[model samples]
Target: MPKLNIFVGTMYGGALDVAEQVKPLFEQAGFDVTIFEQPMLEDLIQHKTDVALFCVSTTGSGDFPGNFVPFVRAFHEQGPALSELRYGLIALGDSSYGETFCGAGRALDALLEDHGATRLGERLEIDAMETFMADDEAVPWVEQWIDSQQLKAA
Candidate 1:
């Protein structure tokens, strides 16, 4: 019954919706959960959180939407400083954008990985242009991640 500190970042609300949905499920599973709206990468660097789940959307021209800029920069600049972090992530985008679909999600995952954060699960990519509910895929992905962590602990 340890706590899972969930860090969620969103743009245009889709990522937030996903985070909110996934959170209740985690809470129901006997895990104490603390949810935070991470607007910048600095939020990640500043907090000593366990099991961060980044939910982000790509903005114009492969950019992170306005709320996510600080987070992306912090990850890029000082991600390596977090030598003991563990993380999971969900990225939301439209393939229709062509030039830079899911770019923010990709960058965030890479930055976190470069810093020694163990990815608790696969990077869940949601292409809105292709599906109606990308977040639905996260259900199984997160359950598997949680189980994996338990096995590792034993």
Candidate 2:
């Protein structure tokens, strides 16, 4: 079985809530799972996991939550190539923000792709403006995502 590592960035905790909710599902799918909140670049670079999951929220004006700013900078400025990585991303934001909605997630997703990381599937974007409760909407979406990948949840 492969490992699944979950990382999240959030303001007011919405993205963190979604990460916690999905952790066990990955574990049940026979992955050795680890979760991080506003992780450092070293935290991601050191791990040799088969899959990395990101749940990140866009903060004011599309900025990354304060805790994640350093990680984002390091990812763009100093992170190593990640050709062996496979990933999934969950972008949490209010559609009312228009162009900036989920900007942090999109930025990270592009960063990873640029470094040669492959996506497990399409990124999941939860619209807080539409759902009111982002985490609630994320649960089934994640389950279906795992299923769509044809991954066995042992």
Candidate 3:
């Protein structure tokens, strides 16, 4: 089995909380999981991971979280390409952010995919101002994503 790399790029802790919620599932599935509280894409595997989940929260006006600025930039412009890797993303945000709710996740997912990474799952987005828990929204998506990856691997 291939190791799964989880990149938690967040500001208000929502993304980190999401990662914590999903940790058990990854462990049970026997994936060697590596986490980055603050990610630098160049430092994390690009083409090496079977699946890399980027959990992020959008900041002011659809901007990248402060901790993720460098990574978001490098992953889009200066980092090693992820063409050989399969990846997924989850975005956490307040719908009040309006025009660009979950913008960070959307951008990263698209940028990575554009550079040739195979996007393996339907990227999820959750609004903090909504009526449900963010982790809850991500759980099923993660499960479905994992299942698809398993099929691909087999």
Candidate 4:
């Protein structure tokens, strides 16, 4: 089975809830899914993950959630080339924040690309002001993402 790492960056647990809710979808598609509440850069590099899904909520002034700060810092400080990494992102934020909405996820998307990681599909940005449940949008997106990537259980 292809290994999938779901790295969650949540402020009030909304993002984590989305990750948990969507995990089984990937599992049913034959992926070995693991959700990391407090993700570390080493988790990505050490595991040789086949794919990664980042479910992050934007916090204070468009910043990363506290739990995800260290991982971002480590990636900035000692991250290596990730030309082989393929990933997806689900950004949860309230659009009321204006320009900073979904900032963390957008920034992470760029950071991953900067290191040569390939994003498999367009990033999903779930606006809290618009969606009552992040997982509602996330579930269908994951289903499409899986199909678009031509992924199947190995």
Q: After superposition, how far is residue 9 of candidate 3 from its true place, in Å?
A: 1.2
True-vs-predicted CA distance for residue 53, candidate 4, Å: 0.5
- Regions more than 4 Å wrong, model 4: none
Worst 10 residues of 3 by lDDT: 41-50
Displacement of the residue 75 alpha carbon in candidate 4, Å: 0.6
Question: Which candidate number maximizes lDDT?
Answer: 4
Q: For candidate 4, list the clashing residue pairs, or say none.
A: none
User: What TM-score do all the candidates reach, one by one?
Assistant: 0.83, 0.94, 0.88, 0.98
Ten residues in a row with the worst lDDT in model 4? 145-154
Q: Ranking by lDDT, best first?
A: 4, 2, 3, 1
**Alpha-carbon RMSD of each model:** 2.7, 1.3, 2.3, 0.8
Candidate 2 lDDT trough over 10 residues, lowest sum: 145-154
* Model 3 Cα lDDT, one tens digit per residue, 52-113: 88889899988889999988777657656566777778888788878898888888877887
Write the residue-wise lDDT of candidate 4 on 1-154 in tens digits.
Answer: 7899999999999999999999999999999999999999998888867899999999988999999999999999996899999999999998999999999999999999999999998999999999999999999999999999887674
Name model 3 segments beyond 4 Å from true. 77-79, 151-154
Q: Pick the candidate with the highest TM-score.
A: 4
Q: How does each model score on lDDT?
A: 0.72, 0.86, 0.78, 0.94
Using TM-score as the measure, what is the rank order of every candidate, best first? 4, 2, 3, 1
11, model 4: CA deviation in Å? 0.7
